[model samples]
Target: MKVGVVDYDAGNLKSVQTALAYLGADQFVSADPEELLSADRLVFPGVGDASSAMRVLRSRGLDAVIREFVSRGDPVLGICLGSQIVLERSEEGNVDCLGIVPGASVRFPKERGLKVPHMGWNQVSYQAGHSLFRGIPQGTSFYFVHSYYTQPLRADLVLCESEYGEKFCCGLIAGNLAATQFHPEKSGEYGLKLLSNFLYWDPERNL
Candidate 1:
């Protein structure tokens, strides 16, 4: 199936594209609204400042395209910064976001005594029977590099949780949309498996 990787001038496009290529996915990277809407599925991956990212997405009208894609009930996978900006707002830039999922991205508390970025591999505890985690063992470790974590307004939207200084939502799933705070592209075998699962995931049957 053709997969569209949203490109809004954020980082990590190459890695995500490379991973999808390894999976033999028919994919293209574009910010063009029509191109994105034509794909079977969409991968929204990013790494950078949230405000600047939103600025680029809005400038290119990708923000609306993304919402439109989701509204059409097409599958959308969000990663890292891509995951954060899908929420209603982000504390990083104190800016509004796409709001595909009802939530807010907030910075990790410094009072918790952990490093700001919470970099490196961390285990993710996910709910069973979800297609996104299909074939993947529970509590699998995934690569993460971010200071902000998503707090989905609906607890049921959380598909996985991880611990740094404290437990935080690491993955979210709502209908046709699924997102992860961790980078599956950088997480080796398990990471690749996750992407492969996403490729075949049927939101109707899986969600």
Candidate 2:
């Protein structure tokens, strides 16, 4: 499938591309609107400041395009900072996000006896089934490296949660939009399974 990685001047571009390629996805990477919109699946990933990332996306008018793409029922998988961008707003930025997933992004609590950028392996407690996490076993350990966390407004949409200072929403699925706090690209076999699920994802059957 033509899986296009949204090149929004964020981080982890090469890793994401490599992972998708390894999962047998004929992936494409582009920052152009036409190229991004034409793909079968869109990979909206990032690893940097949310405000700055939003600025870059807005400069190229990608913010609107992403909203349109997902609205049309195209699948979008956001990773790391990409995940946070799905929220309604973020404490890290003045610009509003795509709002595909109803939520706000906030800085992880360092005062709560946890690291800011939670970097390491963590087990997810999958709340329920979704196509993206289809073959991924519950309690599957995925690699995470991020500071901000999403607090989804519609809490019921959270499909999975993982612990750090507290149990935070790790996986979100709302309609055609799906996002994750961890880097599935770096999560080894567990990551591969998640990517594979997305490759052959059928939301209709999944529902």
Candidate 3:
């Protein structure tokens, strides 16, 4: 299957590209909406500021394209900032987002001397039966590098939880959409396994 990695000039495309290459998956990175819409699956990965990213997406008309792709029941994998902006809004720039899911992204509280950007490795607790977690042990650690956390309106959408200073929804799965606050491409072996699972995942059979 051909996988399209959205390149909105704000994502860390190279690393994601390398990971997909390692997996030997057919993939392409592009900013063209038509090319992206042609893929069987899509990976929305991003870094940097949320508002600026939103600006780029809007300028290129990627915002609507992504919504259309997901609406078609095509599989989508969102990473880091990609995950945050897919929600209804983000506190980072107080900007409204794609609203693919009902939620908002909020910055971490500075209480308890916790770091603003919750970097490094942290374990995520997820259902072992989920296709994305197949062949992966429970409580596997994933690499994270974000100051903001996503809060979906519906609690049932959360697929995985993790703690930095407090518990946060690190992953969410809804219909054909799946997203993660952590960078699976940067998380090592288990992370690679997650990507592989995503590549082969059948959204119709999703849990």
Candidate 4:
């Protein structure tokens, strides 16, 4: 299947491309709306600030493009900053987001020696019978580097949780959309497996 890696000027396009390549998937990187909408699947991977990323997405009209794709029952995966932007809003820039899912992004607190940007490896616990967890064990450690985390209004949308000072939504699934707060592309072996599952998963059928 053909995968589309979004290039809205904020995604980690190269590394994502490399990971997909290793998975032997046909993928392309593009900022053009037509090119992205034409793919079978889409990966929105980003590393920059949330507001800046949203701005680029809007400039390219990718926000509407993404929402439309998901509305059509296609699968889309958002990573890192990409994860935050899919929610209703973000505290990073105090800006509204795509709202494809009901949630708000908030920054990690510094109280009790808790770091602002939670960086490093942390174990993720998934909901029972989650397709995204296929071929992957629970409590798998994934690489994370972010200050903001998404708190989806509907708890059912949350597929996985990871702890920092407290628990946070590390993975979310809604209809045909999926997202992760961690950098799966940089998370090593299990990460690759997760991406492979994503490549072949039909969210509608799985649900």
Model 4, 26-71: lDDT tens digits are 9999999998889999999999888888898999989978998798
All candidates: TM-score = 0.98, 0.95, 0.97, 0.97
* Tens-digit lDDT string for candidate 2 (26-95): 8988999988888988889889999999889999989877898787887888888888888888899666
The TM-score measured for candidate 1 stands at: 0.98
lDDT score, candidate 3: 0.92
For candidate 2, which ten residues in a row score worst on lDDT? 198-207
Candidate 3, position 175, lDDT: 86
Q: Rank candidates by lDDT, best first.
A: 1, 3, 4, 2
Range of the 10 consecutive residues with the lowest summed lDDT in candidate 4: 198-207
Candidate 1 per-residue lDDT, tens place, 69-187, comes to 78888899999999999999999979999888899999999987788899999999997888888888888899999999999998899989999977999988888989999999999
Tell me, by lDDT, which candidate is best.
1
Alpha-carbon deviation at 26 in model 2, angstroms: 1.1
Give the per-residue Cα lDDT of candidate 1 at 150. 96
| Residue 146's lDDT in candidate 1 | 96
